[model samples]
Target: MTIHVIDTGFFKLDGGAMFGVVPKSIWNKQNPADENNLCTWAMRCLLIEDGDRLILIDTGMGDKQDAKFFSYYDPHGDATLQSSIANAGFQPADITDVILTHLHFDHVGGAVHFSSDGSQLLPTFPNATYWSNEAHWDWAVNPNPREKASFLKENIYPIKESRQLKFISGDSPFANIDFIMVDGHTEQMMLPVIHYQDKKIIYAADLLPSSFHIPIPWVMSYDMRPLQSMTEKTNVLQNAVNEGHILFFEHDPIYQAALVEQTEKGIRIKERAALIEFL
Candidate 1:
């Protein structure tokens, strides 16, 4: 199996919301914030080449929102979903599967895009089967008050309308890949566990957004249930330390991946480096 880091780009989000109750003095040292108190984050996606399947995990937020919408987040950077895929020697038509961890705009926005003529919205990978769980699908489509803003209709409805969406349950449909369901971040958020040779790489998703979130208490305020998030983190961190799992971060601006160990001060990052170094 081969893996490529598809960097769609970087965007700004308020540091307080990302770090929950963690104080500015604490997390600011980790990720310095701008004058507006927003911190930059990477919308990093993963592309896997195994057998004939070209699977993309999570599509970074697409550039379809109007200027007013984009002004709030300030999305910036050169690399896009299409360019990164092409850099990996593939095209949108070549992708066989798109595994969405969740339907939050930042994660699923790139899955669909405007048609060339701008008359219709369509699946970005017209030939690929988009994978999402039924539970999360229902949650996103009929979003609750707290998460409604994150579940934008333009980023989601087009996939189902195009008849390219499929739901996975119980077991994963691909070889050497499995799913772990966690409800803390959102209902049934699917984390893909990729078995590569001797190492197991867990697509951390929002469950552990970055290496800075390894500590049990650094839960994101964006989460619906912060306490449950802490519990989920403890369990995942324990398994990562016990089995030597490599966490593939999705939102970290600097580090791409890391390994954790049970330290004197609970589970902490053992090493932080590019994904290629761990491989």
Candidate 2:
């Protein structure tokens, strides 16, 4: 199987919300904010190419939102979902499965798009079965007030409406990958734990967005259950260390992947490198 890193681009978000209770003085040292107090983050996605199957994990926020909506996030980058896939020698129609970690705009926005002439919303990957769990699908469509802004209807709905959506109901999401469900960031966010080249490679969605967030206490404020997030992170870190799993960071601007070590200071990165090295 071959794995590809799809660069969907970058966007800015409030550093305070991203770092939760962590002091700006500390988090700033790890990911410094701009003058407007926003930090740049990568909306990175992963592609799994196995015999006759092309699986994409997480579609970055698409370009369908209005300018006013985009002004808040300040998305700026040359890479795009389709262009990145093309760079990998494929097209949107080539994807056979799309595993959305969660329904947040940044993760699943590109799953659906505005149809020709912008008359209607449609599934972005015409030939793929978009995957989300039953619980997350319900949670997203009937979103709570806090998360409503992140779960836009245009970014979702269309996949199911287009008759191309599937739910992971006590079943495997895809081959060569195992799902790890965590509720800290959002309800039932599925992290894809991939077995590639005899290595346990984890696509650390929002569970461990960046290497800086590996510390158990660095939970994000956007998380509905911060304490649960901490506990979940601690457990994942422990297991990752024990199993020597390499983590593929989604929102880290620079480093692509890292291996963890059980240090006296708790779980920390042992080695960091480009995703190509891990693959």
Candidate 3:
């Protein structure tokens, strides 16, 4: 088995919202904000190759939204979903599975694209089975007002319309790949736990979005339940440290992956390195 880091691109978000109630004085030191108080973040995805199956975890925000919508986030980067996949020696058709961590636009937007002349939308991966959980699927389709803006129908409906959507019920069919269900960020967000190359590497998705977010208290304000986020983070971090798991960060601006150690104060980053080193 092999793993590749697919950097879809970077986008901006309000630093305050990303860091929750954590004071700007604290988080600002690590992730410095722009004049508008918005911080740039990477939309890094993961591509896993196990024999013939090329599984992609989390598609970044696609380029289907209008200029007005794009102005809000301002996604700008040299890499794109198609470009990154080709860089990894694969195409959209090569992806056998597309695991959506959740239905958030930034994560699942690249899963679908607009058709020619912009009349209809289509799945980006024409031959892949898009994976999402039933609980989260239901929650996203009928979203709460707080999260409704993030869950766009354009990014979702195409897969089911194409008859390739698969629900990860009971347990996932993919071997050595397990999920950690976290509801704090969004209802039933599935974080991939892959037993790869004799080591357990966690695709930390939004649960631990960036290396700066490793601290238990640095929860995102967007989370539906902040306290649940703290508890989930603590448990995951404890297990990560105890079991010696390398964390694969999705939105970290700089660090690709990191090792954490149990410090006197709490869990902290031990070393920051590329995913290839861990592999």
Output the number of the lDDT-best candidate.
1
Instruction: Give the alpha carbon lDDT tens digit for every residue of 22-128 in model 3.
Output: 99999999999999999999999999999888999999999999999999998998999999999999999899999999999999999999888898899999989
Q: How many backbone clashes does candidate 1 have?
A: 0
Minimum summed lDDT over a 10-residue window in model 3 is located at 169-178
Runs in model 3 with CA error above 4 Å? Answer: none
Q: Rank the candidates by TM-score, best first.
A: 1, 3, 2
Q: What tens digits encode model 2's per-residue C-alpha lDDT throughout 1-279?
A: 988999999999999999998999999999999999999999999988988999999999999999999999999899999999999999999999999999999999999888889999999989999889999889999999999999998888788889998889776856688889999889999999998877888888998899889989998889989999999988888988998888999999999999999988889999888988865
lDDT (Cα, tens digit) per residue for candidate 1, span 1-279: 999999999999999999999999999999999999999999999999999999999999998889999999999999999999999999999999999999999999999899989999999998999999999999999999999999999999999999999999877899989988999999999999999999999999999999999999999999998999999999999999999999999999999999999989999999999999999
**lDDT of candidate 2 at residue 161, scale 0 to 100:** 86
Candidate 1 lDDT:
0.96
Q: In model 2, which regions exceed 4 Å deviation?
A: none
lDDT of each: 0.96, 0.91, 0.93
TM-score, cand. 2: 0.98
Q: How close is candidate 3 to the true structure, as a TM-score?
A: 0.99
lDDT of 3 at 157: 87
Instruction: Give the Å shift of residue 232 in candidate 3.
Output: 0.7
